[model samples]
Target chain A: MAEAVDVAGLVDRARDGEPRAVARLISLVERGSTALPEVAAALAPHTGNALVVGITGAPGVGKSTSTNALVRAYRAEGKRVAVIAVDPSSPFSGGALLGDRVRMGDHATDPGVFIRSMATRGHLGGLSWATPQALRVLDAVGFDVVLVETVGVGQSEVEVVALADTTLVLLAPGMGDGIQAAKAGILEIADVFVVNKADRDGADQTARDLKYMISLGRRDRSGPSWRAPVVKTVAARAEGLDRVVAAIDEHRAWMTEHGELAGRRLRRAAAEIEAIAVERVRTRFPAADELAARVVEGELDPFTAAEKLISGSLGE
Target chain B: MAEAVDVAGLVDRARDGEPRAVARLISLVERGSTALPEVAAALAPHTGNALVVGITGAPGVGKSTSTNALVRAYRAEGKRVAVIAVDPSSPFSGGALLGDRVRMGDHATDPGVFIRSMATRGHLGGLSWATPQALRVLDAVGFDVVLVETVGVGQSEVEVVALADTTLVLLAPGMGDGIQAAKAGILEIADVFVVNKADRDGADQTARDLKYMISLGRRDRSGPSWRAPVVKTVAARAEGLDRVVAAIDEHRAWMTEHGELAGRRLRRAAAEIEAIAVERVRTRFPAADELAARVVEGELDPFTAAEKLISGSLGE
Candidate 1:
């Protein structure tokens, strides 16, 4: 662990667009370092510039292939690309979980590309605590686009939408992933739908199912409802990727026009801040450990235990 | 909210095999009622008699249909049964999610059957926070078997294993769910594996995949190794259902001889009690809202904000 004041030099290098510095900063966040406050403060000015995109779906959904294709398209437009792949199962950047990123080796030599795979060391914070700070590191390091890929439809993955200007939910044909999309409430979280492996037998039906499920979703009536367009693609072949990128751009444009781009960032920042605050308060609650024992012994109940914990944890 | 004394009466009736009392008690647990301590005290003696089984897998895996089948099997053995279906997507129980449970109408008129569909009510507790207490309510009311089911393979769903005496992970062929099971760390969480829709093409291959994956998991070195037996079942047709039940019985017998079942229950009780205490403590933390504002403003980093929140909230 570095001293709080010492992290500023690392932050300076990170902001100056040094890949090693950027990697070092993200590593600190992943490890839940004590000097995190220093890092966040130093990098604060450099964030809020990059376009953050989140890609998530069930495993084996060609999310990696789609991400690779999308990265190529973005780089063709001369954009600096950074990808943060969050795999909760892997505590470290183990080899097996990140086979796709290995396939992403095509981007390795390109100075315009930076990729980092993160596993949360199996902590309680999971994605909510680690990801935002990692995104901040990417944002601060001057990437034009930061792409996030997460697996599963759990609430943690859904929170990935908060960090993105647009969220691409990848599905495939013949796997019942479309019905999965509905059951996981992916219909509500997706900003754009990408049906990968579209050359398969039931691709059309999968697309139709997603469209129908999206129709049944409770629309956001705050303004004109943006219908999530379902697009089919053969990501392994890089076919239909141009259409996917076009959808991303159009969604980004819509976000800009409707002021949703700013709104998303604001909410993301707010959630990150709240998560941090609640976590910090957690340790200070007096008798939490003691009350827990009492509850286990049947001497107290949990809700009342919580109420007492709050009172004892708080100062006048 | 019922009065504390009134809840005692409800607990008594609940113990006396009253359905309305059982329903009211569970409702209180689900609503996170304030009289939780009183309820816990009353129900404490009646628990520890029920066996909890957690059924989890990805969506479209025929979990609910299979649960229905398993319930009928247990009821045939003259066992009273209760089901807790944990679906985070349904904020309120409505639509496609709970539809299968309704289809379990074969046991609808059985006086010995009780069923609950829980959707987390969009709370921070996720699955770990709610299910244990609900299990207690059912346990108090004298259900010999309490079956818990959860969707998806996210880490949260994996935590459901801690609450069950035996955790049954369901998978089907052709959905890529076998690979999904490996990816979501389901290989390690499953105590008994049910290959539902086993009559479908590639069911044999799917079973082979699970067997291979389980063999690959790092064996628990603390005791005699338990090899999670993979059982193929056409659950809808009720074929091979007896084999699945036999596997569960064998596992329970092994747990009993090894003292693992008691250990599992002790840990479950500890966790439920601790969660209640922590949840109660959360509300009393001082100036959490204030610190969250400072974090959003970038005036304070989350780590420092948490440190401050704890210090401010803690009493002398």
Candidate 2:
């Protein structure tokens, strides 16, 4: 059995901006602690004050660099910032690449800035599922802004959008034009597009393509549609980051005004609740192994098997 | 009411290798139709005969070309083959890239080959959830080989491994080295590594890097270790494909001999059954919306809210 930490004490210290306390609280969330109800109660009073921003893009698009730039931008505005990078690397290696990228120049000494790279390899579907709660920890711990960075590879990237006030989709030249971006399903999730590595030769072309794609994909035109603005940035040099921040702020304001923020949070929380409940139900399904054998042997079809498993576990 | 398709008649036609029947059965699976129970009952007896090979990689890795080559290879051996490509493109767009790639000139006329590109963007988490059932339909329809291809952007790609007897992880010369491949979470799922477009520069380097990375990431040393062999292939030109086929066959034989095939199938069935049951539970949780509001308002902790919602729904 894992040792029981003092949830109340941890939350109090975390609220007072103690790094150790904050880290411990986040670890509880990361580990999906059995004491989550107490921890959630302890932290509930302090959340909903921070702005959560999600930064995501395909590999080689400099997502980490953009996140570092965004963090600096938020810090420059005199706001405490926390970074939670969802790394795809294995737990065995601790992901050297993500680590190096997240620990940007001179970030270690900054008391106002906190960075945590959560390993996604700990369990299947672990990091993304854990991230929303971990964000709550940082929010309750007095961070003015929490930046969530994810490698845009999977369903986790989609999940990140539901948890954020603003989602920035990053793309570079030759990764694909805006049409290719649309094909990859990034078009729907992006509140703003960042054409990172804008100093490259095809930067203007990429921007134009994105703008065109955005126009074509504008889902609603009856009301004031949130046009996903494309911002060009040479993130490696920290150029054009101001506009990216500006776009995020604009999107955040729009979401707030249109009540989309509340809707997104409600949906995210509901999804989280459902996920936890389903996991609990799954734990009782020891008979699933035998049921699976029946399906495999053609003794029963999958639906009847599934119905039995659910009824057996949920007592329905 | 979807005008009821004759479930038994479709099964009979599908077993007789009628393309239209196979296509309609797969569509029912892809759509998560109300008739799925009937479909499963009809198709259950015909499954467990086909070999499922999952081909996955990062986008632009020539996965389609490789799949086409594999299909042809299977055809040359007088085996019927089916290609199910989980395309990321939205259904509104009809996935031109996936379509053009899958059409494979002259092979379109060959009824021996069945090609279906499942649109991943139809619904959130749709393709992965639908794939196993679709595989069941194809397997039952008397195909000797089924090549399941995915762009591998997320958790869905990981889910594919549960259904496949052998998983081929594709990489190219310029798309990072083996360490980069491991970072993308492909190392664990890969049964074989194919360096496609191998005529390009750094092909040898990519192969060497993968071999080195595999040696480093060897998770088990006690039992008969399945070392993922790196093969070079210019798939577009159909070069080095014989070696690829040989590797896949060898892996398939090894899995069957080890009883791993039965174990994998049972686990896959259990997972599919679990996913279905969870979805059923989710559909009953209307109180989740109210609970979400309380969590967002900080009036109730999320964990507490989840417990209440689950108990209310499941009568726990």
Candidate 3:
């Protein structure tokens, strides 16, 4: 499979903004193909230009509608946009959720917009391993902006924070989202917060709740700490989207000013490198099954078995 | 910390059912302390005796209440039980959910019962890494049954499945739990279906929905397959508790009869060993930050940086 992929030609086509070529490249990344090294090497020099934004919220927090609106907002500025909707809960491949896809129909025929949905069904490292590679593909292919939207369940919200240059944590009124967000540990990662469906009954209350929580936690760092702004939006009508976009841009500007953008990107790269390297080492230890059998039979402990596996494979 | 630990002495005390010794051993595991290898070595040869049961469900599904009832039922059978309540969402250490700890007050003073709450917090491998070690500590300490109850959010339900000999997927009536469970990709991992809060309306409908989903997928494997039994209970009042216990025992018996028990344990051990090996490899790559900086500066790609880090460390 690796031998069949013409990495250079595909990279060239992707650079030229051929959507098919871009899709194929992302497929390779998503599948964690053996030709990834070649693909990455080919795409390296042209990367790092796109502004990566991550939008995440719980299942009913209007993430898809918000993403659709954000895509339209970015396109109005004549910026080419790419959207990667990630479903950490769904393990199936090649199929996006039907409802979300229908809502995104506005972008189906637009040449300036690219939208793809990915599921981490059988991937061992989950989003930590695959999403960055997909981001790298979109970044290298000349998309001016890339938005990663993930279902905010479990650890995916935290993982998305690592992948984005700016993260938008979406909430809706009367859902007790403020408490849920804090309990899920996502409140600290937000560069900007969007209270979508702001026309709801308790929109002001939710916004006030978030501001109160922010104030309690905000002693401010020694340096200028970016205060996560809360913006209200009725995404279905595309209302309050300009402020959302402006808030995102302001956050990006703040990150650049603090040199925090480079620092975050560096940390993301480090994590990506560590995941790949660890996966490589794991595959080298083919005696895992036999060792595991010993462990099951109580003949060896797992830690000792792991140590033996490592030494046998790495000759350490 | 490792140098100060008397691993052998702690193991000896733990084997004698000293609660303090057992607590210390679990603390070491939870902290991923340097003494882990010593602790594992000490615990080996005395492990694999306990029946590991995993109970999981979404928030407000009565996981803690169900667990509380299960503890009472097992105690009635004169079997020693150890409950590990894992909250993957909370990152706090030395602090369990206060409400859950209060709910288990019935067993707090029972000499034969031990209950502990763990949070992933800063732990890199999450439940996959720590929960198994905690189980080993309890198993080696002579518990007849170890119940691993986790908050079923995100990827945790799947992870808990990997750790249990028999997994009970809990749901409540009137919550559209059937569809929610299916979407969360948890329906397949359940070895036993639990519809708690059976006194509520739609309990029978929920049970029917589960049975229908189960029937659609159950064509019987190549051999005799153990069909997951949906057991209903009003755990708050302890109504129908006996049936839930019976279902769990029956599932365990069926797994043993089919030799599936050994197979599950083998797979679990393999995963545990792999997590440890991967974590060790991750620690050896100290040049990651420097390489990541270069990648962030657009001088190198992450894949190539990973390759260099691997080869430089492993000399492969």
Please compute DockQ, using alpha carbons, for every candidate against the native two-chain complex: 0.19, 0.34, 0.44
Which residues of candidate 2, in runs, are more than 4 Å off?
A1-35, A38-261, A313-316, B1-3, B56-69, B72-77, B95-111, B150-159, B169-190, B193-220, B229-244, B281-287, B297-301, B304-316
Candidate with the greatest lDDT versus the true structure: 3
Ranking by DockQ: 3, 2, 1
- Candidate that scores best on TM-score: 3
Tens-digit lDDT track of model 1 for A1-316: 4555468788888767787888888878887787777888777756677888899988788888788888998998999999887766667547534664585589867877888877754753778888889988888778999999886667757778877889998888876756677888788888999999999999999999888888778454565777899999998898998888889889989988988876676667656765775565355454456665554555555555555554463221
Model 1 lDDT vs. the true structure? 0.77
Residue range A113-150, candidate 2, lDDT tens digits: 98988877675247645887898899888999899898
RMSD of 3: 6.6
Write one digit per residue (lDDT tens) for candidate 2, span B1-316.
Answer: 5447789998998888788888889888887888888899887877789999999998899998899889888888999999888877777795744584547574878999988888776753476568888999999989999999987557768777877989999999998898888788888899999999999999999999999989988855678868888999999899988898899989988888889889899988888888777776676577678887877887777777766755564232
Whole-model lDDT, model 3: 0.85
- Tens digits of per-residue lDDT for model 3 on B1-316? 4557889898999899899899999988988889998899878799899999999887888988888888999999999999999876565643585745685678667889999888966775888899999999999999999999987566776788899999998889986656666777767888999999988999999999988888876765566888999999999998877998899889989999999999999999999998997787677667668888878877788878877776665232
Per prediction, the TM-score for chain B is: 0.86, 0.88, 0.90
Binned by DockQ into CAPRI classes (incorrect, acceptable, medium, high), candidate 2 is acceptable
lDDT of 3 at A153: 64
Worst 10 residues of 2 chain A by lDDT: A307-316
Q: Model 3 chain B, poorest ten-residue lDDT window?
A: B307-316
lDDT of 3 by residue, A1-316 (tens): 4657989999999989899999999888888888888888888888899999999887788998899999999999999999998876565543575744675589878889998887866775888888898998999999999999987666777788889999998989977756666776767988898999999999999998888787766775566788899999999999999999999899988889999999899889888888887777677667778899888877888888887876675232
Better of 1 and 2 by lDDT: 2
Query: Among these predicted structures, which one has the highest DockQ?
Result: 3
TM-scores, each model vs. reference: 0.62, 0.64, 0.70
